[model samples]
Target chain A: MSRLAALVRGLDPRLKLGTALFLGPALWLMGLVQAGVCAVALLCIVAALASGQPLGGRMVRGLLVFVVFWVAVKAGLDAVSGMEWAQVAAGAGDLAVRLAALLLLGLSLALSASARALGLAVAWAVRPVAGGERAWKLALSLALMVHFLPMCLATVAEIRQALARRCPRCGFFLRMTVIPQAVIRALGQKTWNQTLAVAGRGLDGPQAWEPDFSWSGRDTRCALVAGGFLVWISLSLPFLS
Target chain B: MITVTDLDYVYPGGQGALDRVSLSIRPGTLVGLVGANGSGKSTLMALMAGLYTPTSGSITVDGCVNPGEGRAVRAVCRLVMQDADLQMLGATAEEDLLLGRARTDATVARARELARRFSLLPAWERPVQTLSWGMKRKVCLAAALLDDPRVLLLDEPFSGLDYPGMREMRGLLRESRAVGLTQVVSSHDLECFIDLVDQLVVLDTGRLALDGPPDAVLNHVRSHGVRPPCSWSAGQGVRSWDEESL
Candidate 1:
């Protein structure tokens, strides 16, 4: 809710999205030397939560899934390398930290930023890459992704509830599969309804209302802090070798 | 108010629900288009809302054939679909209406006004997944009416209204009619709209079958040995319709 509250109250929206883009990937790569990166990610998480921007509950669930996958991947890598138990444990711990750093940081960015801010930031980024309608199209797609990501998660929850309620007489293959299938069906239905309401509504080009965001002093400081961290990370990575 | 001329529509399976159906509706008139399950009543409504493009022919509103042309079809006209579930877009009824309204064009004060007019809606906004059937229908109806559209299309609208709700709906429709608003309400349930609708349009296997006044259609059906739109067997005074129709 803090994430939502901050977004509603308005911040340097462009800074929010710009922060997300670079921070997201940096966290993921930091898995190479996990501990420090995780600490950084945790800072991001704390900042995001403090913002009072409401994040989807499903996002937390997804991060948990990622954690499971990351751990499994790290364990598998250690096993394949045939490392000693001590080294393997250390490696696993490091990888886990790295994965957490990436996921938590990504989540913080997604939670703290509003769609308008995200769109504006992307537009700024894309302006040089692509011109005219193409840039806006990319921006619109990104905007849709940001707004609809939460909605899709909410939808999957409703489907799950419906699927849970389906009490088949026997645990036949069809019965077991039906529950998952019902979820797909529900999603399709929701999509169809969107198509319905959007029929005459133009899907072409950018909408009349583009997001308004300005890079403020707060933004400059945040960017500089990130730059400083990058410098430190680069300097430390050589020492690790 | 509304006119359909030689409207032809073919579904995915090549099912022709509406085939060259033509009907004219006057302003301040409540027109009822009744038909069986696959008789193309819903298809016609879809065409009217510009949700689906007709294969051929034309559907005009206040003289405009295409809804995509301008504000006539969009601003003056709106459709309330058969499935009330399709209508509830936002977490709450008020939010639902706002989402459909172009965000840039809408203001919080205007939204509040529309919500207040359909005051029953605020109660429907809960977990949204937990609203009762009638309340859901009401929420959907409220969404369609937001921004005060000039012509209303209620496809099987009176599906789950209680006695009081139905009465309230009738009052709204009458008020709309009195103000010279055009409305096309499609339903097989003729009992409730006996007085509400001025024109009757019946669809039979994708063709316009009956189009006239309620009394005239009744007389025509009786004389031709066809069943009346409503099953009135003898002199039973018009049953006051309070139950909702889907």
Candidate 2:
């Protein structure tokens, strides 16, 4: 693995997650130039984090397709609402950049940390406010979401392919309407199966374990660097605007 | 041992899946559950695994009444669903094996040993979605075995396996049986388990059609939409599909 990948992977999951959470709102609140800079930086970070992973290429491609589709839809809506062409273009571009950056931020964290580590980080972060049990439940929910999203997407794709094969000449509107219903039915069955599988393993019981997290000196240094960067961004906000 | 008394499972939509089905499974015996599509074999497995409450009836697994002592039953039972994709709860084989359990050193070592035994050690860290259908099924089986459950239920365990995969699965089941694990395997393919199973239970249209040893149940399976094993049809005694025996 590259040094950058190693460093990102070695960082405490809590720090990585905290930075991502803070950067999401910060990216949107910044001026376009600042957001653009942040987006570029996030893109590089995501690339580094995703290096050598099997799902990295597919994830990046899927995200790119979604971003393009989102931009087109936003621009078309703005145009339909009778906005000025220049304003529509600018608004759509700004939203697309920020959205891409936010997604990249999330992707970087997901690629760097295992789902269990992320769950532990979430539990640790939420424990003070939600209590240990609720925090653990929330963390489990997050982990299941992480685990099921890809399966859901795969089910959607499978339904789409089956529909296309069986109804080759179906109109666009019919395909769109049928796909969601089919996906819901398929996902419902899958969800029930997953629930049974989990129950069989006795995972539905009360949380009996506590989260154990240790911080390293490197984590402290990384947190300080992140704090200084956030301070600089906060101070520069007015001038950038 | 598992005992079912007049089990009736009706779907929420009033569709009856299993009607008046009753059977008994002896301890430390491998039972083959054979039926056509939607014949309630999977439903019966789920009920025995403590996954669902029977609409009407009682299921006892090793002295624990299901839906009454479901948690206790679940503690000693593990079910491997037909669709391995849905059964997988982790991104990788190792993670799936260690999921929902205390990940102590001993558990981790057990998980690793199971992976190695199942030939999953090479791809232990790879995403399960990237594995082939047979490999994914093996991962599910390995995960099910990680807890050392007394009762193991497999639904359509041989559906997507190739010849070699089938051989490996048969070997695994035999190994489990040898170790006194009570296993109920549901399958549409008779040849896969005809010789291996100690007893055969056939369900036809959500009702018990036949239940006995393979020799007695083999001839009647055809009337219930299941084909007799090739050797049986060829006037030969019940035979295994294993090529080594051939």
Candidate 3:
């Protein structure tokens, strides 16, 4: 892979999350206008491929589920609003594709980056404006969130497996009882102790090792390309509208 | 060497955990800290590990007061708590072992070696939460030993291990002792580590009840809510605890 491609793999998760946060509304607006649907899809495909993670069966299933749910909800609303079937189908298709593109952006970012790096990146981003203590605390909290995501997923899977064996026909109420208890037990002590351990290891406050995140020449080129694309999109916006 | 002088520790809620507990641990010796549940073994180990400041006394590791010289104390001593799940901070077993170590070829090699020794080679890259309770404990042990700390304190090391796992841990302790690593193993099970420990310290309700060589003080273990080891009982040809009465 090229340097930019490799850099994207290790890019700060904060940047990726920020990009998604910014792009999400843009994609939503584009969907509303029924414009740039193809462009957004192309960007999603490129981002996914560049992330170097295969669209696994589970991810595909999840995407399909999301798309189906979106279309169903749209159809329901349209039916209640007395819209024709053809118009409803078209609008729902547009919304589904747009939502898929947004989800792809989030998945690409989540799969490619590390949480600690994201926390550090958040710290780095807010360093100029935020006080040192506030930045560090925010960084730690963000890092904890990153760490908790996978742990929560694993806990759910574990509880599901156990429940499947013990009470295969159990209802949602049983899961409500068991899962939270198990997850809490699994997650509660670790966070507190690990945070203390981080402090105990003499790494409690602000991180000592500064991350080298200075934009390289390649990054400048990429930025230029992105700027050109943004200009092109802005210029096309008037025509599309 | 580790020294505790009139060590008194009280929790924030004003509950005493260790009361006037004082002892000197010789360099490179394996000590067994046996006590009943809530008998302050964990608290004592945590204090010696520099995790807590002594409320009214001093604990010095190699002449450095623990609370005052925490960094210095941590540089030489490592504490592996009873709950391995809480102690393991790494996402994966390998990461936990290499947590604070410099990411060099030598450090990685040492981490791999320790993982192998602890029977965690199969799950070296596996997330710690996916591992079994015994495997998690082993990973924590490997992480503690990865830095080659001079003083290793284990709280209930054999709590969740099987017979073979316990034997493996005992062997590791012996090897660590052979390599001049001082170890304090705190456990409720006397039979598991009784023979291996050169010194045995008994705690009863947050106070030191007995401290001496294993044979000398093993007789008094029963009085402290801890059953005396089989060897200690059998040595006197007594099957019942009351008959061996010390």
Candidate 4:
């Protein structure tokens, strides 16, 4: 994990996003879909390691819920319809792997990407299709959304704790009394003031859409390797299907 | 130094908060802002901190004007908000201090030093919720001072603090004053700040009622709905419960 993380820690965010974007469609096309799943899983692992994020209990629980509701439900339905156990098992395994790959990709991206870097990536991606102002606005909105997520979570947690302390015997409904107001307050004047503070710390004014990414020797080598792999997989598609 | 020249503020709903409120605070002094509830103390402090633009008139912090170049004013004068929880953007003290700022090795070291100075080193890694209100206040103060702003506007700094906590804050304010940091602390509670403040500025119904040295303003302090210190209230008062009985 350390070795994988070290490799990914300094990997350009743009390159990471591009590779993830390309990998998804490529993973869908391969006949032996496990190969694509494994590849995505590897990337997710690298991302997690690089970001130094622990695989927390909450994530495990969420994965369990997803598997039960999404993967297991389909498998059980197939079996009830008299599909063979072997086929059902195979389908379930395939779906589970694919789901895991997608989840990992998302987790890695969320963990490793900074708001500014992600904003730059989004703006750059949209610049050709959209003009610069719209691109930058969309990017800034996305960055602000990313920044607000953690703040909202913390606010909820703090409100919960405050209620608990003031009323230990407080009913769940009673405890939730402040949640709506807290959310409104957090998203309202508080968020605006925070944004002002952030801007005051030198993020104000007309921002140039200059993304700080440069192609290095390593990027070229990785690109070539990825291109060769994609070509080989596409060429071998007929045999797999 | 902060100079407010004929400052006027009106809320969006046509409610006036401050009207022609003019005052000047010199460098390296601790000034107390006293007013009743909704008396424009907080509004004036917010204006000084550059949180809100003055609807009319102006505020100059170290020669930087508000309503424009507000960021410059904020850079020189930071406000420690009344609600510590609202200002604490980080789960821990160190994280809060690092927000919106680069966390270089030097910055991290400076954060540690500030935390220690503010007696927050023990709870530096702990979640802000785990700390007492005083500790949380201290963390907010430390976070504000991380950039070493020349002026601090502390709104209700002693609210909810115990006796020892109040003493500690008084000492901290005194120490900051010694080092030439201008501070304007607004609080409805006058007892806590009376001894520490060099001058008392009283606001009554969005207007300046009195402004003078604390020793000279005890009569106006009571007139403006504030209870002066016990020493002044007991015998040297213009009117008191004892005096009224006689």
Top candidate on DockQ is 2
Error of 4 at B54 (Å): 1.6
Clashes of 3: 0
> What TM-score against the true fold does each predicted structure earn?
0.71, 0.89, 0.73, 0.68
3 or 4: which has the higher TM-score? Answer: 3
DockQ, all models: 0.17, 0.51, 0.21, 0.12
- Can you tell me the CAPRI class of model 2? medium
lDDT of 4 by residue, A1-241 (tens): 6665555645667777787786566555555655554556565574455344433335545655785678888899999999999999998877776666666665566555555567768878888899877876776666667667766887778877777788889787865676678668766876766654444333333253355455678767767775676666666456554
Comparing 1 and 4 on lDDT, the stronger one: 4
Off by over 4 Å in 1: A1-13, A30-59, A105-132, A135-192, A200-209, A212-241, B67-76, B82-106, B120-148, B159-175, B188-195, B215-246
- State the lDDT of candidate 4 residue by residue for B81-107, as single tens digits: 776765664545766666545556897
User: Where does model 4 exceed 4 Å of error?
Assistant: A1-56, A72-93, A108-144, A154-182, A199-241, B83-112, B119-140, B158-171, B218-246
Mark the regions of model 2 whose C-alpha exceeds 4 Å error after superposition. Answer: A31-37, A65-97, A114-116, A208-218, A237-241, B243-246
Worst 10 residues of 2 chain A by lDDT: A205-214
Give me the displacement of residue A101 in model 4, in angstroms.
Answer: 3.6
Query: Candidate 3 docking category?
Result: incorrect
Candidate 3 deviant stretches above 4 angstroms: A1-26, A29-78, A81-87, A124-139, A150-191, A205-241, B100-102, B116-124, B129-132, B236-246
- Residue-level lDDT of model 3, residues B1-246, one tens digit each, is 999989899988899898999999999999999889999998898788787889988989977886688768876788887767555655567756765455678888888887777778999866566698888888877877776778999888898888777777777887898898999999998877776788999999999999998878877889899998776677752232222211
Docking category for candidate 1?
incorrect
TM-score of chain B of each: 0.83, 0.96, 0.92, 0.93
The alpha-carbon deviation from the true structure for residue B103 of candidate 4, after best TM-score superposition, in angstroms, is: 6.1
